[model samples]
Target: MPRPTIEDVAARAGVSRALVSLVLRGSPKVSAGRRAAVLRAAEELGYSPHLMARSLASRTSHVLGVMVSDLHNPFWAEVVDGLDAGARSAGFELVINTGGRSPARERQALTGLLSFRPAGVALLGPVLPASAFTGASAHTPVVLVSRSSRVSTVDTVNDDGRAGSAMAVDHLVSLGHREIAHIDGGNGSQSAPRRTGYVTAMRRHGLTPRVVRGEYTEAAGAAAVRALLSPAPPTAVLAANDLNAVGAISALEEAGLSVPGDVSVVGYDNTWLAALRHVSLTTIDQPRAEMGRLAAEALVHRVRGERVTPARHLLPPRLVVRATTAAPRAMSGL
Candidate 1:
């Protein structure tokens, strides 16, 4: 039997073939309702996209696929800004999708991107398995940001999480914060390194390491802070990221504590949100935009066969002091 086609899907969905084509190509111009109808029809007919055949016929591809882990995080927006600028300068267009921080969804996003057979793909902070990276690299060049892979074909770009965490700890210690706590990025990418740094730095400073479980979200940070409220709250907190720090501050205020007076907080990721006048979060600054640019450059190089060795770019992170941090009240004699 002959396989299903776009025309068949269009007829089934009562839409024009162009509309069906746009839906298959994942165009945002298509209405959500129409797109859903087209997708439903295609699924019913077992229709599949043949992007590989189209690529072969065209003999050139200008599309670069991008998969982002969490669209809600402001950090990703800055990174994508750099990626977009880099890709555009290289005469390529980017098609972006988000995995919503789910490993399963990330795998699906990866598979969907691969179906397009783009020249290359960039995954931003993905939590997908190693097998997924290796499998994807078999068909196209893959570059990762905020994640690591042992696959020979994959390139990676990441900030020095361990050093960044240590910097936060050092800053807190310098402020005479002996009772310090860390809200860790539990199970998140690069969490282990950050946790290790926090522990090592606390031990070096002769302070007991108090690590609270948290994720890469504000809610997690708030919850972690709430958990720390039991016995005696720490004088300072090192959050997993900017969002988490903001959340921790909010929770502290709700608990009738003054920021930097009752508790000083340090955050990782100097995202724009952290620098706002109202937020003015003291944080570890990761070069988010630069990492994105590097990832894109590496992927484009691999696509053009310009370099063979895997690119591993690990950028340094520095501390950005702001209004959110100060010495403990005991040290200040306040």
Candidate 2:
């Protein structure tokens, strides 16, 4: 059977196609009685307007495109929750895609979103270069979450990663952990600031910093721990994120070392996983949902021509101490 169209709706309602269009578009000129009749007819016929077609015809879009760097990470999902809420409240819908944390794939995903001519675009933890963002921002308003940009056309929302990392280091130091190691999130967004913060804090406390090159993956965390064990493992470890910290914990337990007893572990991004009783990890908290909301607001403002200047939202981070960290074994006895 042919799909129901506006013409069919108009025929069923005994109204002109023009009147049906006005009613569907929510025009105040249409009487309430006629509007109700048209809506009832369309519903009875299972007819719905094609959003993309309407957007193209009106030269205005109600869709916002979102590209997330990694779908496997729960942190991105939490951020998307905020983005979706903010977009829907503003009479806009979201079309989401993932880039698998690959720059090439992100570029491709971005191109695909632009093809739809969405009102705006949001990139969550994108690894794409500045040039790519510059090109995209030229055609569409772009907002970045968990990433930084100097492009005047683009907006960014991020937490103070350096301060968060420093907080973690200081917490460990206060627990009498002198030999602390950091598992760094290599090549990931905001990784540099986090690493810099860890090094700065370690030096400030007159303690040597040991950094293990790792990616934002559980495997990387476990591998870094394995490497650390052979060369004398640090009494405390700061992981790139909650997922990485969990992996490090698993590796340490497998090696017959007890968490918080043999070694204390801390992580960044206090994701839901960090709160699990079994995984009760101490971590730095980034307002993931708030960042997403801010990004959405920035993109919407840009789309509506409400703002011409760039928006830079830098939120503060807090540390949540949990069961994973404690005083060093030697200090505990004293």
Judged by TM-score, which candidate is best?
2
Best by lDDT: 2
Badly placed stretches (over 4 Å) of model 2 are none
TM per prediction: 0.84, 0.97
Compared with the true structure, model 1 gives a TM-score of: 0.84
**Tens digit of per-residue lDDT, candidate 1, span 1-334:** 7998878999999999888877876789999999999999999999986656546655667788999999988999999999988888897778889898898999999988877778899999888887988888888999999988777799999998889999999999988889989999887888888999999999999889999989999999999989999898999999999999999999999999989899999999899989999999999999988988898899889988999899999999999999989999988889
- lDDT value, candidate 2, whole model: 0.92
Q: Each prediction's Cα lDDT score? A: 0.90, 0.92
Worst lDDT run of 10 residues, candidate 2, spans: 50-59
lDDT for 239 in candidate 1 is 96
